[model samples]
Target: MPATPAQPSFALPVPVATTVAPPDLTDSTLLDVDPDAQMSLGAVALDSRSDVVYATVELPDGARRELRLDALRPTGDERLPLVVFLPGGAFLRCNKAMALEARRHVAESGFVVASVEYRVTPDGATFHDSVRDVRAALAYLRSYADDFGIDAGAVALWGESAGGHVAALTGVTDGLPEFSDAAVLQGQVRAVIDAYGSSELSAIADDFDEAARLHYRHRATQFSAYLGRPGAPFPEIPDAVRAADPAAYATASVPPFLFLHGSEDMLVSPSQTQHVHQALRAAGADSTRYVLKGANHGDVGFLGHPGTGLPWTSAAAMGVITGFLHRRLDATER
Candidate 1:
């Protein structure tokens, strides 16, 4: 016998909670209750699907990269409007799951929320590639609208920082042939929510204060990399920089836009939002701008988390956002 096989030992399982006594049903009586009384109900049950591959990009070197999105929707048969969210990582990475709590809140409010992932600097993708990826996501969502329980015609774009910039570009450049691909189906964008995103790439550095400017040099490098000109001086390629600016493409036909920016944001200037807002207004487009006082870059103030102990809570920020979406998407009619 091979030296008696060692006995396997197992640790005792820990109880998840203290055991409680069961209610006694024997003496229980059925009592009449008023069914029409006012009551409070919590959030609606939500179903989430993650890592949904929306598109695949084939690089010049024959390498294929898959772009994905995470979707959150209510558990029901009713089709709802779609809100596509883009997470900001300075155009270097696409962190699609960021601010999931806020996204869930939006989904709970009767919209299908999708957080999309696009190619970034690491993939050697330029700003044009990011725009294309977002458009591809919109097309894919529209193609599978029935499966996802989404209304493809009433889609919106929402993003923060770099994502915000991309969302704005995608919104304003809706039907432009240069920014669109014939192979990709395009849908009408009803609204856009841009949070602390730069509208003019070349003016970003100038908007920062002296102290913040020191750190922005690194950001300039990142922008250069996103432009497909790594190690090149930022804003040196004037035409490329202009092409990436959303304000440069603003027109009257663009959909309604809601711009949110932090007054204390040192990374991306608040002026960025103001400039685009003014441009849209000048172009006779509907646009709204909000400056959150005492809020910094990527601030929890934007999310309205109670844990931040700020005077304004999630209710305040999300109220404005959801209200805007409701009006723009005409959710009440649906």
Candidate 2:
């Protein structure tokens, strides 16, 4: 009874509005603006969807694995051209989220960009499996074009390093029976952007400069792993290696290609791209090659990241890439 006597005397403090009101200026000249003045409407807001399963594969051990892709698109109702991106991890892993900011940049440029995941060496996957996975991803996208706001007919392949090789090979071998299966739908690629990707695997080592040769000698093991021929003689060129070369399949009907390689690349060697470019040119295919000066393999130079030596190299590389893309895959009406 004694404790309850004064317990109810406390009062709660009332809330106060800390916001300040704007001064009224009904006829202020500051509000006046030129209606026709050049102004930025603002960048298109991008909508991203991750882990979109594009295909399923049955492994040799009777297990099933689901392949996925990450799509970044502008928020709108209209369908847009799709750029399927294949990332590089020496064919040992496929990280769909790699170079995400770059992909977003592409998305903002009025295209739907999808970074696809393919079976890698860890999954007992070979070059054939990677090719199949990429084709399967294309098929899946085409099949679900409406759902993803994709223009099924207007699609392109953009891959880096190993993925670049796959994209090149896939682009050149379109409609070929050996590279595709009936389970997946087939679609034509409008253009291909090969970024420092290898073309002839066997010749890669030989193509490297003295510095590259010393730095990337381990690439032989990577090649062996990708070909599913581990411990194979590094010097001997296998039939699988030849078949996996994009240059081997270069033809007049192949899609237009834009090859970007760094002059300083040591891992895959710029010569890898040169061989493919030469083959495509010889076959009467439309091909363009640019060997970036002072850039290295998968370094900030090749990927347009901030780095030393010619800071504009990154912007220049991206400008060239985007320009090529716009020419090949025109912006779809949105």
Candidate 3:
């Protein structure tokens, strides 16, 4: 008799918990309810008929997080391109939905998708810590590439909102511990998709007095908890914010870049993408940009998820992302 298939040791794939509860629709939106923090990195979970490997991990201090990678097998022993996704919500929010969405588009593009969930705020962690998690997740995948049949050398970094900021930062800052640390994340990945994220707080600080501005997702109200200084006053956090903003760190050494931004996004300025676009162009890096008309900051969600058919919904994002990933990854594979 043929060998029996091994049972997947992890939970079933989860449908993204859309924020349908309609809690406080105030200026400061609440953090989305979190998913289970299971630390089973490299563990295989079977979903439907497919299997996905979870790159579950715990930081040095034992804070747990997970990176979900597709359990895909290539035709031969050939390896496949992979991307580590970091979802964005200022500095305070995001989850596996962002990762799953990336997988949906990139899977057929000859890429393995890994969605990462970083440690949330008020844990006494900083913006830097979250970024570190991304680096660590990438490294973890590389260390065990063979187990998952992944091509460590071909990994891409992708993200939305704050995730986009981190993705671009990874692109801009080369030779940093995130890339250079052989112990965790691979030192080099071929590409990046910085989807509509901004690092500069000053851009949003323009109309600082408006109470409406404080209520959005991009502002990182949790981040403000540490800053203490008001946005109207333009606190010293710019130096910190600038440091955190990937655009300020753009250099010639960054990777192939694709930027997507909404023309009418109320949360982050479209100029945010422009900044990175110009920086990448000036650096002579391979780059491209898409300006989604009338789309909000959650543009990807509007495009990719089902039932977004009316206008800017999740289903629409799916089509946009599918085309984007195919075009870029196709060129990349060549």
Clash count per candidate: 1, 0, 19
Best by TM-score: 1
**Residue 57 error for model 3, in Å?**
7.7
Tens-digit lDDT string for candidate 3 (267-328):
56666766777777777777777665444555333324322111222333444554555555
After superposing candidate 3 on the true structure, give the runs of residues whose Cα lies further than 4 Å from its correct spot: 1-78, 99-102, 177-182, 205-220, 225-234, 299-334
Kindly report which residue stretches of model 1 are placed more than 4 angstroms away from their true locations once superposed. Answer: 1-42, 214-220, 300-313, 331-334
- Candidate 3 residue-wise lDDT at 213: 45
- Whose TM-score is higher: candidate 2's or candidate 3's? 2
* TM-score (all chains, Cα) for each model: 0.81, 0.80, 0.66
Q: Report lDDT (CA) for all predictions.
A: 0.73, 0.71, 0.54
Model 2: which ten-residue window has the lowest total lDDT?
Answer: 1-10
CA lDDT, candidate 2, residue 247: 90
Task: Give the per-residue Cα lDDT of candidate 3 at 41.
Answer: 22
Clashes of 2: 0
Rank candidates by lDDT, best first: 1, 2, 3
How many Å off is the CA of 99 in candidate 2? 0.6
